[model samples]
Target: MLTFVAAVSTGFPAQAQNDRATTTVDYTVRVNDTLYDLASYYLTDPGCWTVLKKLNRVADPKHLQPNSTLRIPLALLKQSLLAARAIAVSGSVERTLGQGPFLPLNFDAALTEGDHVRTGPNSFATIQLSDGSHVTLHANTTILIKHLRATVLNGIVDRQFELNQGEVETKVTPLKPQDRYNIISPSVIAGVRGTEFRVVYGDGAGAGNTAVEVLEGKVAAQGPNAPPVLVPQQFGVISDSAGNVGAPIQMLPAPSLAEPGQVQKGLQIVFEIAAMPEARAYRATIATDAGFLHIVNEIRAESPRALFDDMPSGSYFVRLSAIDRNGIEGLSQIYSFRRARPSEASAAATRTANFEFRWTEDAHAGAGAGAQQTYRFVLATNSQLHDPMLDQTALAGTRLVLSDLKPGKYFWSVAAAVSPNNGESHEKPASIRSFTVGQ
Candidate 1:
């Protein structure tokens, strides 16, 4: 009798087929039940909401019906879960169209037409397209992914990515030749193969230029009414209104060395001075290979002034040092600056007797040590520390306000003084700085 029952159970083909066709999962939404939580419960992954929306073409998740039939793909659900887990472990995606800002990826984020994506400084982003093509947006770049699709047949994949304003390095891994990826800028369109390349864009005088450098593999760039040019291990530039693509410019081998004071012209350099305890007067110097040296020309009141006019057109090295009331010296890190040709009227009309100062407490350094340092501020009309019109002292972190400074060159310095009762001395170093007042 046991053998007969086992034989009957083993021969039940119809029952097995019915079991295979039966549905094991069903989900119903409730009031206040978010898509994230619903996806987590039924699909075992919250990110499945994105896949579900894409699959069903549901315009909005917030308006989901209380009961809707959603046919979930087991394979897609699993893949979405894995991708979400990877993104959670790593940093979130930052989208850049060509060279733009780093846009943080939110849940269920979608890209549409005419959106510019940009990466931040020292950051990058990766996007997995529907067509299985992956785009990695490099740092300090902007790129646009215009269109994407997945198909085995001859389908239209018309993409127009523009490097609107910055630089981007792209690596395209395509599954088939029928799929097309087009990189467009204001001046050039590069039809790429499975390759790696970097594109940069910049604007000047109401027009933009694009530069394309091929790193590996080859790309064909087409210009208006011109034949295609093959770019391999070479770079080319496209300018406005010309509609003519320049010949490929081969990259030279890396320079073996650089000469001292050889700064690139037209590069802007910024200098910041660390706060000092008792320093007020500062002097800056610049030296170029052409034997040109001068002080900063553009002087602003908010911070330290630029000492010299646009540097003589040459590569230059710059240095800045500060002097205090007691004639103590403090120096800053040496940096490089290059100035283009001086423009007309770089100096504006000058104003007199307009200035202001304030003091704030220093939080980083411990306060009120056994020997407290007092700051004595001294202001004078001349660079020489004499004929001072305003003088004052305050506790550390106290802002000393001064205003109505005449529009002219002036010198200022600070000295540290200690209380005798605490056996503290006033012989510590001081600081000095100079600036001009403008109308």
Candidate 2:
């Protein structure tokens, strides 16, 4: 009777109950895999790597051991997926599921599911894929990501994505060797084992050429009737018209940074000089309506060099000139500058011997003008102002003081400088005023 009355009960364990309350998704680690790709594949969001790293307390995703288990929060993964699916189009609207107007020129667009992205005239859009891959669409480009998924095969999960495009930059970070991603262009097919690279298709008349730039990793570019090019910053230009494959050329270094001029008196001129393969020395010149003057004559030191400090406040044309090791000279585009008023000095007069000397700071010229400004005060025994002393008594700054008891008349003037504001005068202008320093 007691055996017949026995009852059987089925219940979950305490750990299972606690895990159910937390709501987690299980993921296994794979070879050559990173957290970025894993989070993107499982969570359907590229930015989820940040959250996954935080939740899992992973400092570095590169060292993830194969066959390790990861617990991902369902709520966080859902939020990330929604965010990734929402694309911002042209700073004017947000489009989800890829339904929107064509992307404008030089604009950006994001894609989730159901995105049939197309490019307008002279326009481009960059797509951040679900598996941490980036695809950039060149002008007149077309692309569609039909399916994205993570599947377990042989106890290993691999992320897969397919792309049909005009052009794209795919950066794949796979967890295992089995992870697969493919991009199919009009005339070329690209497959990534695990790497980062860019593929660009020409537009309009240039339709047949495909250019690929590898940033960090390697990629294989395959086309009909041609050997696969292992592009490593290596670009392959295939001619659609002739079916000829051109050799890959390394990209040139980007243009250097330049500063904008600010107007003080006329305009303050500031410029940066870039390094070239043959550049050896540099020289700068400034030309007023009166005449041309040398500003700088320095030996080449470094690239993207900076030239700043005070110069005379005046409206003058400025030019930076350079010389190569072969003595070949290159001139920069001519620019203009004007020094306003001397920020610290005003016009004044001083008397020497029995004559009166009137001197005023060139507010629009010299260091205060935001360019290098140097001043040299000269004292001559003749009024004709010829035969000046090579080592004549000179004064800098706004104030000039001359002393001598010579009774004969003397001529005096100032020469402004155009070098760095290191208080050294380089070139002098035609003396503006002539006065007797002594009677």
Candidate 3:
């Protein structure tokens, strides 16, 4: 094996100390593998052979035993640069490539290292890394892509992001040895191998405060003033701008929605979560897809109710989360629902004629006029309709008339059920009406 003469006589550089402080990867020595060859192939600088010799305590730099392992500090390793693709971008998201001007972060925007991203108020953006990991940026946030690199020979990756401000939610893919996934905030650094977590840096209202919440796997949280601490699942940590990181605290549990309707058939869509013990506010988001890859709307509510009035009729998923006093969001729960809206129907009873009870609706109530429309009617002596005196289904007409009646108050309701040509069932919300029948 050829030897690096300069590496043998030279002293290690001061950078070696910084490199030693970083994570390390193990490389098994192969036939004809020397410190010189290993440094040339796997390291940024081939002349760092002497540093490798000192790190591995090698007796012979020119001849390395086959199958022996050598530890290489990650800081000294060489890696190829990569990019992240913007899969879903909405509202007022913008991006900057290097020193270039900021452009709108449209669909499938490719961002590389040194790029920066900022989201405006009431906006959102989601980017996917080369390894299938995802990072979602909420409104009013700024972040810099510090590093996005990979080493092919050792199959290790290094992905790091510097959070300037605001919040980011991440779903990191499982990591291997020497694989680093870190999000550095102003006050703290959160490092994880594989997890679903959230890191918020000076979330608008809570300036100078950095919070990390782990939903899955574990994270190593480090601050300037404290040693690294392990934060397990359903846990979080808070770090202040003063560089002090607090102990991990148990995160809030998922909140249950207050018995949401199985199928919403109204002009508006609404969700009300059951009040949680320590919740100060609630956040609800809606998406067309189950994975939430494309979010359509999001709202924050001080009260339990969250209303969304402009969504069209379709199947969707709703994710709910609670915020604590410190403005930290908790674990979330997703629920499925169907919205069938634009229901318009009216009911009335004529006293003169044969006690006619009639109702009318627009010809195209969700399903167009060409679709087959059916009506279902229920009548009872009680308001609750516990025991119906008249129960009718699959009737063709909108009006229902009863000939002779006793002197008593009665309650009834009717709904238009449209069977669309596309085979989707559409139900116009029913309206109950009351009238007195005289003998």
Candidate 4:
């Protein structure tokens, strides 16, 4: 799932965070490389070569030893403030400039330091940083952009987000040496250099705590007063309200989907996965994009079946993952599906007609619109629909008329068969209705 975040509170201006420690990078001194050239390439000003020479003690700037590494303080590196561009915004995503009132956020919106963003239930937003990193905000999440700055010369970005509550998933680009990416929660800060990971706070088992799960690279989960815990790939760490980091918790593997969600014809969309022995819950996310950059809805259930509310007839993608015991999420797999509208029917017994059934169809029910729905009518004495009295298929019209029925209580159902014209056929039955015939 595209797990984004929410913040119950916003942070003060990033200027208040100036006390963050200064950092540096190691630059290799290549052959024929002069200090002036290095300064011109990596520093904001080439004149900073004097400072570089003094720091590296390179008496002879023109003839530096090859393969020798020089320490370059980030304070002197060419850097610039950065912003996150809202590439995909879906549902009720709200953004606030600083501490101002939040307005509806939209695509191509620029989010910078001190800005606060949040997603209402069933909403999602994906924002791209200046460094090619993407952060996907899942439903019911909020985050405060504490810092967004980068050393443009070396692709070293420093991103610090404060998660007051909720969760987020990020796909981070490889960072240069000395770069950092950190998500601060109530109790701990989950930090990574270059990785795809998930961070959650104020939810699940560890309410008011922080949980960090590493999907690809490693993450250093550290609490306020405790030491850092290394969580490698497919591992997780949790920090409590007291700022004590837990041991490295093993993440559950990605669960396999029971069936492909290629076509759905129902009032509700359901996706089921194979049950996991240790999974505390299952999480499913729906989006229009395969990258899950525009997550539209999300659901969590104790069972393997994940059902979403009725959606319009359109194509969508769903991501499925398991939440482990520590309230940490596991690896997820994404699948695509097409939803067809109004998989329902109504039945009646007219005075003259034995039984009349009519089913709803998509408004665009014609060629080229791709909404041609055929139906199957089933009649049985039992609600289980077994031992059918009459089973009919390939009924193209919306109205079906049946005569010469026996006198008894009978149950009937109509299933809409939708052919998406993509070589896939699906038959989804509506709720069964019953009628009593005169004895």
Model 3 TM: 0.67
Q: Report, for all candidates in order, the number of backbone clashes.
A: 47, 24, 0, 12
Better of 1 and 2 by lDDT: 1
Task: Tell me the tens digit of each residue's lDDT in model 3 across 204-298.
Answer: 33778888888877776644334456778888777677766667788777776775444555567778789987988888887654455556678
TM-scores, all models, native as reference = 0.33, 0.35, 0.67, 0.63
| Tens digit per residue, CA lDDT, model 1, 1-110 | 00000111111224423632342223455566566665765554578788777766667777777667554543333212011000110123455333555566542355
Candidate 3, residue 280: lDDT: 89
> In angstroms, what RMSD does candidate 1 have relative to the true structure?
24.3
lDDT of 2 by residue, 1-439 (tens): 0000001100112332364347566778878779877765555566878877887788787678788877776444432221123211222222235566544422233345455666544344445444334454444456655444443222222222233444454545433443335554444444555555555555321555444454444554433445555555333334343334444445333222243243433223344655556555554444332112112211233344534445554444444544434332333434443344445223212212222232333333435445433466666666556775422433455343344433333445655544446656465343433221112
lDDT of 2: 0.43
Q: Write the per-residue lDDT of candidate 4 for residues 322-425, one digit (tens) a residue.
A: 99877888877655555675642221121232344544432222223544456788889898899998899877665665665655556777676655567776
Provide the lDDT at 113 for model 3: 94
Model 2 misplacement above 4 A: 1-88, 91-114, 119-126, 138-140, 154-167, 234-244, 260-439
**Better candidate by lDDT, 1 or 3:** 3
- Regions of candidate 1 where Cα sits further than 4 Å from its true position: 1-103, 106-115, 120-123, 128-140, 152-159, 203-207, 255-439
Candidates 2 and 3 compared: the better one by lDDT is 3
lDDT of 3: 0.70
